[model samples]
Structure formats: C-alpha cells, structure tokens
Target: MEAGPRVLIVEDDARLAAMLRELLQSEGYEVSLAPDGQRGLHLGLTESFDVAVLDRGLPVIDGLDLLTKLRERGVLVPVLVLSALGNAADRVEGLDRGAEDYLAKPFDIDELLARLRVLRRRPASTVPVIRFAGGTLDAANRVVTRDDGGRLALSERETALLERLARRPNQVFSREDLLENVFADADDPGIVDTYVHHLRRKLGRELIETVRGIGYRMGAAP
Candidate 1:
C-alpha cells in the first residue's frame, strides 16, 4: 500500500493533540505529535512531514520562534499555525514568519482537515515534471522550461500557483481556489492575479490562459 502523507502536530494541550492525531490517522495520515516547541522543533527539523500544525503557546520555545527557526534553517515544509491567540496582528505575525496557514483555537476539526488538504496542495510537488503547452514545469526544482528551451526559476508562491494549475491541465481555477490552496488566509485574493501575471511573464502568456470572466487554466490559447 502507498504510504499516507506524514503530518507533524506541535501542540501543548495533551487532549487536543491526541484528538488531532486520532482524527488525522483515521483519515489515513501518518501523525506525530509534540507537546512543546522544543520537541516539536526537534522533530520538525529531524523528520519529514507534508504538513506541520503548530500551536503558539509552548514551553522551551514558542510557536512563532520555532517557526522562525524552521524557516531560518531553510525547512520549506508547509506549516499551519494553531493558536488561541486569535487576532489580526497575531495572524499577520504568523504569516509574516512563514506559516503557510493559521487557525485560531476552538477551530472545528472539519475546518482543520480542509486546511490540511489545502496545505498539502500548496507546496510544489517532489515529482519529476508536469508538462503543458509544449513546455514543462519542474515542481521539484522550482524551474519552468519554455517551449523554446528557455528556463526560468520561480519563487515558492509562483511554484505553488503553477503547480496547482498545471497539474490539472485545462481545468480553470478561480481566485478563491488559488488563494485557498496557495496562500494564507491573511493574504489578499488579488495576490492570486498578481502571481498569475508573474507566471505568464516567465512561462509565456500562451502557457497560462486567462479564462476571462473566470480565472486561469493551464494551456496555450489555440
């Protein structure tokens, strides 16, 4: 059987951590939990995980500091910050520090699950290549090859945006869809259009077609 996606849960609350572990495992994910930022940071650095759900309050290292450390160490794994510190500034801080998404405490399990799915999709794939429009997108290396054999690099968000659209070929993705899958909740949906424009310039306008009143799709205009 294929191995399930690996997940790391960094939470101080024993009961809630257990609950999250149980729920995620039931959904066929491999779940590991840490009760404090120290252990969580250790596991997060030492192991591989598709996603990390981090709680802000912890001993030995707070969530924000742990997250900051992770990024400073160049760990690109998607992180979802979970905390009772629910406020605009808190959310902004979490995002500014490289958390992929943020969920306030007392959040619904269903919402958490949905957010996890989105997080998994946001990262560029480790897979070899996804082809479209006579060019190729290498999610693993964050490179895009033009039909003319020119190559260009991409930022994290650019890679995520391209991967989301290119993986589906001609399927159109709305701004909200891109926002949910490729950006934090605190991000503006307009940022989606901005990245789309960026990808078009790098990959060629024909490689990504704007569906006019809709959103964007992966295909050359015919």
Candidate 2:
C-alpha cells in the first residue's frame, strides 16, 4: 500500500506528542515527532512533509521563532500553529509569522484533523515569494537573487532579520522590539545593531534604514 501523507508534529509535551502521533498514525498520516523547537527546526529544514503541526511554547527555540526560521530558510511546508495563546493578537501574529492555520490548545481532535486536511490540500504553488526593489528572496532556496542574476546567501540570523524588515516595509521596528521578537534568546540588544551592520555590508547599506532615534526599517532594496 502507498504511504500516507507525511505529517510532522513539533510538540514538547511527551504525553501529548505521543498521543498525537498515535492518533495521527491511526488516521493514516505518516507522523514524525520532535520534542523541542531545535529538533523541530532541524527536521523542518531537512525533511520533506505534506504538512506540519507546531506548538507555540517550545524549548531551545520559541514556536514562532522556529516558524520564522523555517520561512526565512525558504521552507514552504504548510504549518498549523498550535498554541495556548489563542487571543486575537496571538493568532494574527502566528499567521503573519508563517502559520497556514492557528488552533488554540484544548482543541478538538476532529477539528484539528479537518484543519490539517485543509492545509494538506493547499497547492504548493501558492507559496508567496518575498521580493524587493533590486531582487527577490528565493523562497525555494535561502538566497537573495539580484536582477542581474547574482545570488547572495545570507546567514540564518541575517535572513531572519532581513525577512522581518522586508515583510513590513512601511513600519519602523525599534531595537528593543527587534531584540524581543527576532533575537529572543540573546541578552545583548547590541546584537541587533551588529547583524544590521552585517546585512548592510553584505546586501548593501541601503537595504536597511536606521531611524535616528527610533530603530530600523526596510530601505530601498539593493
């Protein structure tokens, strides 16, 4: 018999993960489990899957951060974000960060399965590409390709920072905000400045505009 559609579950709770794995397997899904965000990210980046189920609060890397990293690295796998943070803002944030669907904790298993079915059915061609004035960030591969066809590969942190700024062109993000959202594990806020400088040097100084007292925003693409 043909194998079922592959599904990856990145949940930290051992009992919950096991239960989910068994249930999904029984329902004819080929499930893979990751106990923490780090492992989840490794699997997410290196493996192929029809869909993914991710928990919000994870160790090593936060769920949203893992989602963001996956996106920045050009992983187009449809992700369903499962989190206890079901508030309006949280849902919006999850969607913005790359989740195809968001379901709150204590959710119905049937509903979750239904949602997964929906996500699995989504066309891979529907994945959007991130573009700028001078080039496009290839979503299939983690590289910025210029109009002239020159490609520049960015480090994971650089890609994450650039992706965040590029996604919201008009908004200015303060250093503190970037530090909190993008560099969650880092204690020194100056790390933000350091990466910004690295991006500027690699992509071009015009790639990121530093607001005098505010912070930084996406500048003219180069």
Candidate 3:
C-alpha cells in the first residue's frame, strides 16, 4: 500500500483550519496544521511535504510573504493558495507568487481535494484500491468491480464518496459530515441520500449499511 501524502495547511481561522485538517486526514493524507504564516513558513522551509495549502490572510506573517520566502529558500513543493480574495487579479497575484493553484474561500471540499490530487501529481500506482465483501474499488480508474467481473463506472462524486467509505470500512459518516467534506453548502443535505441510493443500486443494496437516524457505512445486511 502506498503511504499517505504529507500536507501542510496554513490558515489562521481556528474553525476553518480544524475543518480542513479533519477533511484531509479522512482522505488518508498525513497532515500538519500551522495557524500562522510564520510557523507555516518555518515548516515549509524546514520539512518536506508532497504539497501545501495556504490561506492568503495570515497573522505574524502574510501568506504571500510566506510563499515568497519559501520560494526564495528553494522550496519547490506544490502550493495551493486558498483565500477569500476571489478576484481575477488576486488569483493572478498568487500564481505570480508561485502557487500551483488557487481556490476561493467558501469553496467546495470536493474541488479542494481534486485540486490537491492534481497538484500532488500522484502517480497511477499510488492510487488506492479498496476491497470489500462483494467487489473491489479501483480508484485509479474510478471503477468498481464485483467478484464475477462485472464493473460499475462511477462519477467523480460517487468515486470520492466510495473512496472515503472504503478507506474506513464500517466507520459511519453522518449526513452533515458527508455534506461538509464531499459537497458544498450549495448542495442540499438530501443529496447525500441521493448518492447513497445510487451507490446501492449499482453496487448492491446491501453493500452500504445505513444507520437509521445517523449516517452510512460500508457493509451488507446480515
């Protein structure tokens, strides 16, 4: 099995920082959090990471300055800049400063993960393959194959959802948790149920165990 990619996230907002940490950790990435740009700069310069996620506004040292200093020190790991400054010029500036990608605040978690995946340039071999009672989920190709060899192609959303569940078999995920990590607030909470149903229809009704009044997990009925 491939090791989890290491990630450094620098954001001053306590709530947002914690949320980002939890979400990334759930995806099996080894994550470290820095609440200020100074600490972030220190980590970026001293330690090695597959990628870094940074916020534009930071205390002690501005995020842009941190990025600038990191580059000045020859740190070349990909950086995904996250900020509330969503203007075109703002994005251009971040890119100019050497961010590999830029994401606006109030962003969807799914998009963030997708961007990080791209930035990491994860090799095909490192993609996780998940196996359960009835089938295998080939994440590299986003296909789920049953023991009999039948395969079900999945949409990106479905693939991410399945991947998360497969990573921790039997671990339940609540609707709110799924909504926060798998979709944006623009998406209705009911969408979680919709996708769960779709997975059931394709993977078998019993493949995903639903916890009444709680959430869903990976498994089958007895």
Candidate 4:
C-alpha cells in the first residue's frame, strides 16, 4: 500500500503532541512529532511533509519565528498554527508569517482535521532566486552567491530582508516600509538598520545603499 501523507506536529505539550500523533496516525497520516521548536525547526528544514501543525508557544524558537524561517528557506509545506492566543490580531499575525491556517486551543478536533485536509490539498508555491549585480540571492536555499563564486549563508531574517530589496531594485524602501513588510513582528524599526549592517559586512558595503533621511535601496553590485 502507498504511504499516507506526511504530517509534522510541533508542540511542546507532550501529552497533546502524543494525542495528536495518535489521532493523525489513525486518520492515515504519517506523523512526526517534535517536542520543542528547535527540534521542529530541524525536522522542518530537513524533512519533506505534506503539512505541518505548529504550536505558537514553542520552546527555544517561537512558532512565528519558526514559520518565518521555514518560509525564508522556501519550505512550501502548508502550516496550520495552533495557539491559545486566538484573538483577531494573533490569527492575523500567524497568517502574515506564512501559516496557511490558524486554530486556537480548545479547538474542535473535526475542525482541525478539516483544515489540515484543505492544506494538504493545496499546491506548494515556488519562489524565484533573485539576481543582483553583486551576486544571486537564492531565497529558496537562503544563500547569497557572489558573481566571483563565493557564497554566504543568510539567516532567516536576512534572507527575507534581502529578497524584499532585491525583488525591487530600483525602488527605495523606507525603514518603516521594511519594518512593516520584512519585520512585521519587530517593535523597533532600528532592527532594519542592524540587519542592513549585517548584510553589508558579509556581502560588501556597496551591496545596499542608504538614501539620505529616507530609507535604503539595492545598490549596484559590489
């Protein structure tokens, strides 16, 4: 017989995780459980799954952070976020970070299963590798390859920020713009400045240019 669709469950609550694993397995899903966000991240980055069910309050890495990292590296597995914080803002934030669906704690088991079915049926998305004068930003792999053949690995946020700038090379993005689009969860807009510094240090100062009193833009390749 063919194997069932693969499912990953990342929840810190051991009993809950085990219950989910058992329930999903009975439903014909091949389930893998991670008791912490760190382990979840490893499994998510290295494994292939039809869908993922992630708890928002995971240890080591928050669910949103894990979701962001998954998307940055081009993991297209549909994710359903499970959180006790089920307010409108929380749901919106989860969706914004790349979750295909959100289910609050105390959720109906039937609803959760229904949502997973929908996510499993959805097609995976593809992100194109961005080319700039200095190098290529492989958003899928989270790597920057210089024209001279040197490659630099980027963290999750770095890849997202660089991909945003590279996608629109001619347009200037204000710090607020980057904050809203790239760092939506960040309270301080200065985080943009910090990541910009990081990228410049690794890729070269000329790779990105700061517009006076405005924001920043993709510069001519170094």
Best by TM-score: 4
Residue range 1-222, candidate 3, lDDT tens digits: 988999999999999999999999999999999999878876875688999999989998788888876664445788999999989999999999988799998899999999999988843223556887788887657798888888889975677678777778869999887765554322578899898888888888887888998999988521
lDDT of 4 at 123: 80
Candidate lDDT scores, in order, read 0.81, 0.86, 0.82, 0.89
**Candidate 1 has what TM-score?**
0.57
lDDT of 4: 0.89
Candidate 3 lDDT trough over 10 residues, lowest sum: 178-187
How would you encode candidate 1's per-residue C-alpha lDDT over 1-222 as one tens digit per residue? 999999999988999999999999999999999998878877865688999999998888889988876664345789999999989999999999988899998899899999999999994534557787777877767788876778889986788778777778868988777765565432477899888888877766777787888888887732
Candidate 3 error regions (>4 Å): 122-222
Better of 1 and 2 by lDDT: 2
Where is the poorest 10-residue window by lDDT in model 4?
177-186
For each candidate, what TM-score against the reference? 0.57, 0.63, 0.54, 0.66
lDDT score for candidate 2 against the true structure:
0.86
Model 3 per-residue lDDT at 163:
74
Clashes of 2: 0
Clash count for each candidate, listed in order shown: 0, 0, 0, 0
lDDT agreement of model 1 with the native: 0.81
